[model samples]
Target: MAVNRDKKEPVIEVQDICKTYFMPGGMSQSVLKHVSFDVMPGEFVAIMGHSGSGKSTLMNILGCLDRPTSGVYKLAGKSVSDKTDAELAEIRGREIGFVFQNFNLLMKRTIADNVSLPLIYQGVSEAERHERAVQMLHKVQLNGYEDRLPTQISGGMQQRVAIARALINNPKIIFADEPTGNLDSKTSDEIMDLFTALNKQGITIVLVTHEDDVADYAERMIKIGDGRKVYDGLRAEYQKDEE
Candidate 1:
């Protein structure tokens, strides 16, 4: 489905966001400084930065895992920055899907069980959870491996399981942090292809990575440096600027 860019408002909006940590000595460290951006529905954006560049802090805020110390964040037009922890958890469960670099799967659980976890929290029936898990596994092209453990699969396959788990909740947005970090180059390409296909299906995706090749898959790129946004524009423009 082609995204109706003209009619849809931004799915994510961050305004003058900042995150700070205060030490016992009355000293403070700022991680993100006045970071602001907007992500439209069905857009695929990459957040690129080196270590200590505040990309992780921005990701945490975007994912609802952590609230910004100061700023306004609107997800699907609902203000979330000031929400209580319980409310944030609910929002995360309902609207956001997260894919981590580590593939954070339970080693003892079957792939099907892993994917069904999110639904379990939402109190989905056992039969329905299994059914939805199976469907998502199929979507990730892992049709018959639902019964296997994460350790029984290859690194790439485990990542696919993670992606399947992320999608099982039918979230409006997906936040992937270095999703291809653990895979070989060929497998990374395959995973990126899967993400691309999902984006084409109208899912908004925000991926965080330091690799230019990985970021190239995104339609837009936002680069950060020293705890602030350094660039935000079309991928073509970012590439031209790099050149």
Candidate 2:
């Protein structure tokens, strides 16, 4: 699907970012090298790469989970490269939603409690938390499962709960890292369809996937190799190049 992105300010802007880790004996391993990209509002973008391609490093930086060794990252026009760890956490809570391959729900907590965890950090009242948790559960079609434990649900349903948790804050952008990795094909397709529907509703989605079928769901494709972006273009153009 070709999405028509309007000419608006980018939701994410990464400029000349690099990440490196030092090893024993004064050795250093560079994970990312001068990587740069921008994700516009309401765009669905996939970052694809094989293992050791540094795509994970890039994703970590983009999701605010880790800071780059050098360069600038601007989330919603605010530079985040120099922010303290505490400041970055604040920014993450306010601006980003994250979904992971392993649904990171608290096993002991009820679905409602898990979904409302973010709001707790934001100091939302208990009444508001309950109300918003129910609302988000409805959004993800898990309305009746609120009181159930996460282990009681199927894998797909657990992922849905994770999605509801991610949506509780109404974030400006969503970062999904191999979101369907553990699901069967049919369930994967359903989850991707849900992501498509969300994108259609004007949510900016940045998905990281190694599977071509998974990446196909995105309107834009970005391939990273050896710590650098090898391709950044429309999905159609990427298909042509692959052919």
Candidate 3:
């Protein structure tokens, strides 16, 4: 259909993406069926859906962790399907920052060390990595907490450190999969506020959350059901309709 094509070159472009997994007896299960979407530059968007709606599968494909069975995926206007694993890793390392609900920090490392992981992978010098990580911690308002272990900090602070780690790479876009899934109510608000602040500074963010209130924080919301995009629009318009 005409909806599959757009005049503008989206920062992320996916068309007719279908993903299937092989089952025990050679049967295949389709996780994403003809999923297609576009993400523009500097956009703050949230994806919401139920457990079996294929949102996670779409996220994996969008993040380049998995490939689609029959479709095209473009990142930064370049075709992802043609890239090798090393090339994909290079693209992800240099352009995408990821935040997860678990905070995924290394308990054995200090906060500074935890934040420096990506830079280390990029072959940055130790001194430069620590310096950049420290600056990022300061940006997230965790300046002096660098020496502390994640266990020593509050849940909110741990998430803040994770946010800092995600930003340390100065990525083109940040992908947050259920960023506040494990946080308490108050902590969730704080995380949302952090995202707001980051967005104000021009960081593109793609968030996935099932909670409507959480999704409202994003500029745009997309709802998926039965492997199809059921709703896509500005959050304010969606809220107005609900009222």
Candidate 4:
């Protein structure tokens, strides 16, 4: 859907974003072209695409990891197109929390330490960070696993820890890149349920994955192919096609 960015409020607005890269062997590839989308303050959206569908490129732009080759991006009503690298990094750290498919936990660290990582970067006091991390772990239903290393837990439990770590700092939006990609169906369902619960508590979520099975967890889904959006709307339509 085309979001009315000129409306009174929009947490994230992108106008005609285009991302291209120069591949080796004297070839340039366009991954995203004139892509536009908006994410409201508390919306949970999903982006679905095939391997080369440019979803990852869009995720990078939305998360401010890379600037668009040409186009405008506004975050929290402020234009972010011209931010310096340091400035962009600051915004990313403050406004966004990222969860990856691999769980991205530190094996040597306990669950408490992993959840404390983001706050530590923000300069929170060590004692307070530990306390907040413990709280977040509890929020994700990992009440008594604070001392467990990443390897000591099941894959699903580790993902919950990752989710807790993402929420420890209470970011405005959480970007999950194929969060359940590595888990079995049962485990994937559990992880998606956690996402649903988080959304209920008002954290905007944007997930990227090629698997429709995973994307079904979100209320809205956008499908892409050949670097352009093919569909964007309720999941019911995609479900109909599946049937």
Index of the highest-TM-score prediction:
1
RMSD of each: 2.9, 3.9, 4.5, 3.9
Per-residue lDDT tens digits of candidate 2, residues 88-131?
A: 99989988899999999999999999999999988899899989
- Residue-level error in angstroms, candidate 1, position 95: 0.8
TM-score of 2: 0.94
Q: Rank the candidates by TM-score, best first.
A: 1, 2, 3, 4
Best-fitting candidate, measured by lDDT? 1
lDDT of 2: 0.90
Please report, as a residue range, the 10-residue window in candidate 4 with the lowest summed lDDT.
234-243
Regarding TM-score, does 2 or 4 come out ahead?
2
lDDT of 4 by residue, 58-122 (tens): 88888899889998999998889999999998898888888899999999999999999988767
lDDT by residue for model 1 over 1-243, one digit each (tens)? 998757878999999999997899899999999999999999999999888888888999999998899989999999997789999999999898999999999999999999999998889999999999999999999999989999999999999999999998789899999999988889999999999999999899999998888989999999998888888999877753562
Cα lDDT, model 4, residue 187: 94
lDDT of 1: 0.92
Q: What is the TM-score of each candidate against the true structure?
A: 0.95, 0.94, 0.92, 0.92
lDDT of each: 0.92, 0.90, 0.87, 0.87
Instruction: Report the C-alpha displacement of residue 86, candidate 2, in angstroms.
Output: 1.6
Residue 79 lDDT in candidate 2: 93
Candidate 4 global TM-score? 0.92
Residue 101, candidate 1: C-alpha displacement in angstroms: 0.3
